[model samples]
Target: MTASPEPTDAIAIPDSPLAVLQQVFGYQSFRDGQQEIIEEVVAGRDALVIKPTGGGKSICYQIPALLRPGLTVVVSPLISLMKDQVDTLVANGVAAVYINSALSREEMLRHFAGLRRGEIKLVYVSPERLLQHEFMERLGELELGLFAIDEAHCISQWGHDFRPEYAALGRLKQWFPRIPVMALTATADEATRQDMLSRLSLTDPLIHIASFDRPNIRYTLVEKFKGIDQLLRYVAEQPGQCGIVYCSSRKRVEEVAERLLSRGHRAASYHAGLPLELRQSVQERFIRDDLDIVVATVAFGMGIDKPNVRYVVHYDIPKNIESYYQETGRGGRDGLPAEALLLYDPGDVGRVRRLLENSDNEQQLQVELYKLNVMAAFAESLTCRRQVLLNYFGEYQREPCGNCDICLDPPKRYDGTEDAQKALSCVYRVGQHFGVMYVVEVLRGAATQRIREHGHDKLSTYGIGKDKSQEHWVSVIRQLIHSGLLTQNITRNMVLQLTEAARPVLRGEVRLELAEPRLVRVKQKDKGEAVLSRAEDRALFKELRQLRKQLAEEADVPPYVVFSDATLTELARYRPKTESELLGINGVGMRKLERFGAAFLALLRRQE
Candidate 1:
């Protein structure tokens, strides 16, 4: 609940003052790249911190903000985020204020006046506000310490959430030459990272990249022919669990949320088109646990601080792996077991393909699209899902997770050496101008009119794979594309070509492991039978919920505004008998305890 000790001597140099690292920010130690990145920023160097979400990125800037002599200006993207951050800072006894567009003219003037008088340590502003002439003029007058760009990936066109305003951040360095700048993003691929540096005009910034692995999250991809029914079943099984279901379309979000609500789940929909106040209210309710599930599009989550989200379900496949990684990273922030589920179909791939084709940079977009197609292939892959996911980020795992579907019910591997050779041969024979469907047809010896006209049936390889269905061969090609044995060229022509790794397989020198495609069928389980026996736990949970409701009523706030279901679950499980014990709950800060501790304690004592 308290701020960790700061590292004072982490950046101490001979020319700099000799001080212990723990004396400054009240933190006793440094995380993986905190000390190094902090030193770089303090020594007036530009840097990019690519730490994972909840990976102590704040310390990189908070420490530098305290160490430097002037005010640190942070350009955030959301109003609610700025408020939450500023509130936390004030609670921690630090001076922080924000100037968002939500404020009235008078309110804005007062906050600007506070900034000018040097009464604030940090000032959070949206990019649109910072672009204002009056705000820019005021910013020029202030002695700025560090210009921090949160969610820096937005600056890159290749990133998921691209903002035009972020591209304009280069002007900051031009205006304030001596001030140090640090850019931070929770997720960025190699392409995105390079684009951030180039777009921001950072001068050889020191790059600190933490590991992308979220070991606490259990990744699962379920094929859903009846997606809505399956989704309802899953949600019912995890009753009262806080989770997010991402839909590609706003309509899908509405439909999914409505379906969940009809099925007796506390669910809500959030999209860009929603009313501003309604969106804010929905977000607040979800954070407070008045809502158990939030069905949203890409618009909903950026800088969300809810820590105990137990699951994240992707209703549609994302456009790229970076977006998928960042979205799913929202789960398991508290280092507890969490799940990432994706219910996808092959048609989703075509939709994503069209989206990529419409993008401005076709080549970069194509590469990213291929990456997504690889993810789709991964969803259907018989190998450990974790292995394929980690492989995309340029990391590898030798052994299976032993927890994923493939590991639990081991897939039977067949000798695909001949099949691999035939698939690769078809690519060479077809002149590499055809798509996967065409390639599969050619290999399966299907004597269609087009194939006969092209004289493809005359080839020796024709009819060789007739023993397999077209779908089977298509799955083979997909797995090959994902395994790095084949590459899909999106432009010039959408065709499959063999990569270098496929050479050995084609020559029969190496055998490839291939799993037979199984028809995924979701068995209907009785909802009552599926529910775990948490009778005592549920009784305590209800008591805690009632206590929370009382506190919210007294405070005139929503019940969730008091505490999250996860927090209440913790209280029930731990049975925090004392105030000190209650303080250890994730969302129970000093202010919350001071406001509602007695009511909760009274209920706990009565239950005991």
Candidate 2:
């Protein structure tokens, strides 16, 4: 029901998504699995694309929106996500707009008018807004295109961030019988995936699950001791880079932010407890590159679209592996080398588990507890962290990544049969009623009052682990829990209890080969990568960034919309002087070349 066969823009819709990809989005070819997904959607087929955060998931639906006959309706979870997508789309010359609570009524009316007139190619609305009776009636009056559901994982109750409104999205297919619908999510397991498909009523959709590996990110996990010192050291290694340091509580967020600010890091604090306007301002400043880092709780980074974030540091462990993956995915979005470092204490698991325990719903509690166990396993895994994560999502890799801490410097393995026996004996001597920390203290032979009250000093297992550091003892306890020889009794204040699997180890019939406490090694700080390789190119890249900032400020948009850092790097390398040459760059599309090409060419000429 498109109004006419006339193409919307200069780039003719000649039944080729490749042409649209080049002239509009400025890409020569699709990345792995993108071309096939785009072809499915463009051919009026429903699709389910599970691409990683930075793997160009947007293109799979965006190109189809361009090639489709009518306006594509994108149902998004957050208003910020909608705004970010529409901003980039409009910057690239697509007729895209969003209607959300942030928009004025008059602005919303104008968008509605444009949408009804078929002048807008893509319209983004929240699930709540899309379900409004008035909005649905308005939509019914116009010719509809494909339905693109971003963050489709929220439809399932088991997803990391479930939303009730998402559950109502199944009405889309029932209402628009003929139009195709595509669902996209950055993180979801097989259960969530199946739930997403069934909930959306997707009829035999083309399911594309790209590899969940974010190879650009170097994963590092450090045992948290002298946390502030460790943080300071890591920050010192990464001077003048954008990052997010995630804390578990609002108090810690403020403290970390204040300390970073005092140390001249240009940091801001963000949490749900902050004032609405203040939080928005901090997010806007961070996205605009005015702030170098944001020290925040998990509430932050939901819809962050900043592309140049060089690192993501977790000052505390996340609630689950999915949350961890999604949070770390925020960094290195430009596909440049980046870092994901998590400083954690094994005790952090108890704190997170307690949060899960407070829930009254038994089913929900079980699900959350299982997820927490998996997250803890990830933090404590002696195997490759990437392999563990991929395996969690049912993806397999034969070789270790060599990027994570485990793969880089393999942890030393000692026949911990004696050590394991010592730890288990200590837990049992403590009557299996006390928590892991208490058992650890009993093993460490700490002369605390609780130990005195328990009268456990006389036991043979007591002081057995005094030869090892307290951290080493904690690591041993964690490894035993992970190895199935010990289980945390969550129903009973998370006390330590041995499983039947411990009998062989306890009897010395089974040998336990546990890894020793690993020594920390910081990879030589990617110094050559701090800037462009050559000095002149570095200067040009900086100048180009300034130009981009200026153009973005003028247009009232994020700087990434003007040009990403990767594109600027290419521009600096190639020093393209002509429109054709600029178009040859990865992110230089026709509309951008036509708008800002002359200015860049003039600047390059002046530089020469």
Candidate 3:
């Protein structure tokens, strides 16, 4: 679906990228690497960009499309994402259209005509549609300046979310050899990056990999016990806020949504099992601010581009780290403070492993199992979550983020050299053939039939340290594995094996420090919502949001398409009272000022 272009004063086309930035987009300057990427693409060269979500990735291509002479074809993965972006671009007065299933035959013909007439600067199409031989022939008729592949990681089989349709995108460079191509994605490991470069045939591409750290989004890991109660408490902490709760199964989604609804929450469940119309309806309602929470499975994945999503909760652990990172990145897209709470259960790890083991492809199962192990390590980590996350992407950061659950309320640490030796000795005594649970039980002197059958009660290491709880021993073993002192062989029944580094610890030659296992959950302090602090400022911000909702409803677009929460926060803080002052805000472009400036200024004046 296309946005209804609003009536506004004519815009004077800017010649340079920076000029387009100021005049068309209403921003005074470019964010970090944006200008460089824009210039590289405009200079007729292929490039690869890896930035965090809400890091202005769209601007890297959109500006070049405007400054360059011909149409820029954007290969998008999802119809809903294309619509959200195209709506935002159109609202900014950019000549952009998306050709997707949402468009009727007549609407598609109109967009085609617009493209042929050189009226649309940018066109977004899915990989499946763009790969069609007939569709490629039709696009060849247009003056093509550039081809941008959004979510480029999808092209790689090694990526978290591989789409076979995206695999055919390498043909874009072959068809339009001279035209520049830019492949962009927010989450891609080094392997994924290399795979994309080879698969997409990006020729000596100028690579710009931004820091993976998202300072605005706080990371939290909560041990899952009485999970539904914990989830309800967390949801209650942020009343009237919009968030997403992700479950691993459809039944769980329905159960959580029902519980929330029974508790008088504006919540709904979305999954692929639901009717297409109902799923669309739920998505529409949530985007329009009529629903505060949508409990969903991954089937409700990446069609969302909602900038105001304040939080994302994973009711169960994800299969891999990339999926976890991308899903959480959906929150705080406005670069405002948001929260990501992961309710991690050890049982969930076993469930995911069992599912992965069911796969016939042994190689793929190994890859998936490795990824899950890393994800579990992240959840069980006592160090900074951001550090672990960034380290996974090969971006090193030594300092603590001070925002995650671990950093906010650090667990106490003590010299556990004896504990380490005992745990290591037990793994060795068990013939290194047991998983974490079996090892923990063996170490804790668990009185079970298996332990009896194994004749482990007669061993010297058996029950050597029965003073500690089962959880404490388990935590010790996990830390040992994380520190490279041990390795869990997923292919071999997930048995624990000592690493070379464990020799010193096992020999009692090296001291080890380990964090105390937190038996109880610490209450994470809530830093109030994005940017509005004072009572008066919050009141004004609320009023601004009400106005935004009304305008967005009338326009039939998401509220963020009108203006981001970050921009509204600035309005509330600075209290811009004139057209000039409102135009000074980051999101208020020439088109927006002409269309919305009057209403915002009037409200500000009234508040004064």
Taken over the whole model, the C-alpha lDDT of each candidate is 0.76, 0.81, 0.83
RMSD of each: 16.5, 19.1, 18.2
TM-score to true structure, per model: 0.69, 0.67, 0.69
By lDDT, is 2 or 3 better? 3
Ranking by lDDT: 3, 2, 1
Candidate 1 residue lDDT tens string, 236-273: 88988999999999999999999998988989999988
| Candidate 1 weakest ten by summed lDDT | 1-10
Clashes in model 3: which pairs?
Answer: none
Best by lDDT: 3
Model 1, which residues run further than 4 Å from truth? 1-29, 351-375, 415-512, 517-608
Residue 340's C-alpha lDDT in candidate 1?
Answer: 87
Weakest ten-residue segment in model 2 by summed lDDT: 1-10
Give the per-residue lDDT of model 2 (tens digit) for 1-608: 10111123423444688888888888898899999998888888998999887888889999999888898999987655666677677767788888877776677778788887888888889899999999999999988778999989889867777778999998898989789999999898877888888888898799999999989898998867557778988998898899999999999999888888889898999988877668778887899999999999886887666889999999999988888998899999998988999997877899889887998777667767777876886887776788777766767554678888777866668999999999998888788898777888888889989888879988888888888777778778777765667766544656788877778899999787877664221122333222457899999988998988888898899998887777777788767655545666667776787667777888877776
**Ordered list by TM-score, greatest first:** 3, 1, 2
